[model samples]
Target: MDTTQLLKGVLDLAVLAVLKDEDGYGYDILRRLRTAGLDEVGDASVYGTLRRLFQAGLLNTYVVPSEEGPHRKYYGLNAAGRDQLNRAGKTWRNFASTMDALLDERGVAA
Candidate 1:
């Protein structure tokens, strides 16, 4: 399967999950996602997701001045974001569990 399509479906959740613990700038968020095994996630996708989430009222943003280069716009989850994360997480777990069972019944190897 082309993982890019799969990534598209879950990128929102993944980004939200990463921001759950702390706020981060764009590059920082991208780095964290890659570090977490989502190496295929693209720069544009992360940035766009951030924009969409913020517009959706799921995230709060602010700029932090940096001495190195430019001001970094940081993104953090608000209450609605955390609530969505909890709900999406449960949905993902249930779907994954169902898929796992189907695969096992069909004798697919782990």
Candidate 2:
């Protein structure tokens, strides 16, 4: 299975989950996700997801000044984002369990 492809489907959920803890700028969120084990997530993909989520009203963004560079746009989870995360989390748990069972069955059969 292509983990990267799978991750693409859940990238929005991942982004929202990260923002649920606190507001973060684009690069900051990307770094946090990478440090949390999503090493294969790309910068552009993360940035794009942020924009999309913001547009969809799931995220609220604000500007924070930076000493060494341009002001950064920080994102935080809105009420909708939080609700989405909760729903997605449930779906993911169920899907993961189903996949685990199927994989175990395949292993035994093999």
Predicted model with the maximum lDDT: 1
- Candidate RMSDs in order: 0.6, 2.0
Count of clashing residue pairs in every prediction:
0, 0
Q: Give per-residue CA lDDT, model 2, range 1-110, as digits (tens).
A: 46898989899989988988899999999999999899999999999999999999999989989999999999999999999999999999999899889989889553
- What local lDDT score does residue 66 receive in model 1, on the 0 to 100 scale? 94
Per-residue accuracy of model 1 over 29-98 as CA lDDT, tens digit each: 9999999999999999999999999999999999999999999999999999999999999999999999
Clash list (residue pairs), candidate 2: none
> Which one wins on TM-score?
1
- Cα error, candidate 1, residue 69 (Å): 0.5
Measured against the true structure, the TM-scores of the candidates, in listed sequence, are: 0.98, 0.93
Query: Among all windows of ten consecutive residues in candidate 2, which has the lowest summed lDDT?
Result: 101-110
